[model samples]
Target: MTARSTQNKRKRFDPVLLLVLLLIVFLTGLLVQVILATDYLGSGLGDDVARFQDLSGVESPVTAVLLNFRGYDTLLEVMVLLMAVVGVWSLTRAPFPKKPIEPGPIQLAVVRLLAPLMVLFSFYLVWQGSHLAGGAFQGGAVLGGACVLMLVSELPWLKNISSRFLRIGLLSGPLVFLGVAILCIVLQGTLLDYPQEWVGTLLLLIETACAVSIGLTLACLFAGGRPKDDLSGGRKR
Candidate 1:
């Protein structure tokens, strides 16, 4: 076709694109108007705060809302993250490199110094969540950061860890959370309904398991595939 004819043909297709753009703009304007008209924000916060102390049984309002008032939300979120990791695992398993990359001396020094601190900080965050802003997700992220550091530094012991153990580590959190949920149903006749007296202890157990599981899952994701089993003789000791 001639250049001018080609340009005309392209213009013919432009109307469909223009209609989509106009539709998107109209939807955006409608959404904005709805948001502007809503008067629930302040009232909602006040309501949540007023009932927080009694409803949550925890000092931290955020924790109370997440792990108690809306515990199922957190459970589903954890399951979603686990599902994502499972999907990644099913895609492809990359071969372990013959010679692992070694971090420089400064990198090694920093990792050695920082890894322990990160672990300690992660636990502190998880423990503090009952009365503070930190929680299992934040603590798990910190722990994952520590694992990344260890992986990059090529720590001998870390490299030698068996794949089965790694899989268990990645799965521990979800398993524990699911188990607790089932136990609640069996013991309390409702999902996640802990007895008032046992709330704190049960919460602590769930958070600790979740934190460790999240940490390992995140670290395995960073490594990009399931680790090779040391016993399989795929990797040299």
Candidate 2:
């Protein structure tokens, strides 16, 4: 019986299929490298600099690439973040921690002082992304850190906040991105393509919305679950 069981387990291990898959992956990678080495004619690097210059009204080439030239990529990245938060929500039942962790006075005080500073810096980072080395993701991380701080401190207001607002905050990025993509398709004949004249305004708006949504989503992720509303509990001092 033991020998039969071992044979059954061995039957489940498809070594041939595994080897075939490995060989296919290796060949695919090798093909790509060979094409790249031969200087593929369709490569984007050749005209990227010229395209970057012609994309009107945008100061940052990086931003232009992310939000304009390859917007679908950015849109997909935002969707990934949204999906992560959604997956977390789906798997979790108990919103918020069962036992509240009480932070000490110094920790609470530090969070109080640092939260606003981080928020201000995050905004700067988001705004500067158009001209320099910051963007929505960086700003969102700072903002998310602030939210995490608030949660870690177990602030009264945070604990008592409405779930409805939380849900809105979490879903805000994906919804806005999807709406913008659809609107672009209607007006520009392609997804995420902005009108030449309105490139700055539209991209800025999208980035701002994305930053906010990313912030909320990340905070929720750190919390490990959704927050529940407690209308009856008054704010603590």
Question: Which numbered prediction scores highest in lDDT against the true structure?
Answer: 1
Q: TM-scores across all candidates?
A: 0.84, 0.74
Q: Which residue runs does candidate 1 get wrong by more than 4 Å?
A: 1-15, 94-96, 156-159, 230-237
The CA root-mean-square deviation of candidate 1, after full C-alpha superposition on the true structure, stands at: 4.2
Error of 2 at 200 (Å): 0.3
Candidate 1 residue-wise lDDT, 1-237, digit = tens: 222434565444455677898999999999999999988756776566656567556778887777888889999988888887787666545344667776688988999899999999999999999898988989999999999888877775665577778778777877888888898999899999877777887887888889998998888788776555533544333
- Stretches of candidate 2 exceeding 4 Å from the true structure: 1-47, 54-56, 94-101, 229-237
Q: What C-alpha RMSD separates each model from the true structure?
A: 4.2, 6.3
Clash count list over all predictions: 0, 0
lDDT of 1 at 175: 84
**Residues forming the 10-long window of minimal summed lDDT in candidate 2:** 228-237
lDDT of 2 by residue, 162-232 (tens): 77887787677778778888988899898877778887887787788888889998888887754554232
